[model samples]
Target: MHSHTNLIAVLLLTVLIHEGSAIWCYRCTSATPGCGETFNWRGIGYLGEHCPEPDDICVKLTERRGGSETITRDCLSALNFRKDIPADKYEGCRPAAKDERLAHYVNHTIKEHDVRRDYFTDTTFCFCFLDHRCNGASGMQVSAVMALLTVAAALLLR
Candidate 1:
């Protein structure tokens, strides 16, 4: 019985570790060498940071001005430490409402947009909690590692 309990503990730890692994996100902007609209992961290398909260979602903000676009990737926790964004509310990609683009975050709420309302015409926001470094130009629908960990934990619990 004691050995069984130990085994369960190990399994639980493994599952937790796996889940935590995905809490990291690519953190950068178009200004970075390879962090533009088309991310050049190979040349610039991975520039990422871990999320402050486990439940935080990776967010990719794409702003288009006339013909040019800029991309910013980061964790919502990094974006807003004052609050937690309910994952269900922002799990996919959508056009950001005009007023929300420069909303309050604990950090980097807005740059030039804070003063100028005519910064960008089109703003795209994509959110994901799929896996490590999941934030990109688009939000991915599947979180396979999470599913696999859930199944493993369930089987172990059983």
Candidate 2:
């Protein structure tokens, strides 16, 4: 009947709304050799994952120890993203305030030669837009909600 048709239309609209609003970002971790062309790859070492929350931002962390280096990439909270870049940094992610020594994220060590001369060094943290794409909601959610309201009105009219 007409009610069944309206239900189908609403469901289809809901699916379209969800699909258009979905946001995804790259996720990965690498050490020594580093993750090659992280933005380009899609499998194994690099993965495309959903950015679930509103404040999620893509993060890249690099650590250097004598000759070796380590890198990690993932979606992280923007509240912890710092502005000040330090010289001779020893932790992956740190607070913007210089007095704070707590690292917001990952921290690890490296050995200069075999396991004899192990040393931990400072890390550099960088935040970038997810795939240089998503800039948050972009009013898509609002539009979807409006669409649902329209569908409800149409049903009521019938």
Candidate 3:
């Protein structure tokens, strides 16, 4: 009975923690270690820091050309998009707009090729709002652990 009770408490705590706040998302650039084109999820809490403010979403911008790639991770609110979409309330990735893609190619000295042929460069923007308190192996957020422990302690005392 006691073990089952503990399990139930833990489950409740997990849910509460998952929905507590935005989340401690990893913010970094390709320049930062482990945050390159191919991300290392294990480095989630090992580097970078939290978003400037809470309640914001996480964003990953990747610009690719031929064989070169650049990646950046930051809060969604911190981005400045030329054209806006329904990003504020949803989570997903989208390709850059036509004008934006043309601008990117022009600025980078690349050419946006024909649809049937090879495109020199492309830009993809990804956004997400994580609700996981403890995603095993991917690294757990500190605040989540603390909240879980606190709630467990309170439950034990009561």
Q: Which candidate number has the best lDDT?
A: 1
For each candidate, the alpha-carbon lDDT, in order, equals 0.68, 0.49, 0.59
Error of 3 at 89 (Å): 6.4
* Cα lDDT for residue 100, candidate 1: 48
Residues 35-70 of candidate 1: C-alpha lDDT, one tens digit per residue? 887776654576467787868778887888989988
Superior candidate under lDDT, 1 versus 3: 1
By TM-score, who's the top model here? Answer: 1
For model 3, what is the error of residue 57's alpha carbon versus the real structure, in angstroms, after optimal superposition?
1.9
Model 3 TM: 0.54
**Per-prediction tally of clashes:** 0, 2, 0
* Clashing residue pairs in candidate 2 (N, C-alpha, C atoms within 3 angstroms): 89-122, 90-122
Residue 136, candidate 2: alpha-carbon lDDT: 22
Error of 3 at 44 (Å): 9.6
Off by over 4 Å in 2: 1-23, 31-47, 78-119, 130-158
lDDT winner, 2 or 3: 3
lDDT (tens digit, per residue) of candidate 2 on 40-73: 3423444357666754555566656787766565
Off by over 4 Å in 3: 41-45, 80-89, 98-120, 131-158
Cα RMSD to native, each candidate?
7.1, 11.4, 7.7
Model 3, 18-135: lDDT tens per residue? 5665565566777766677656755554644555556766667777888888787777667754343334445567875454443343334335434322342677777666532221
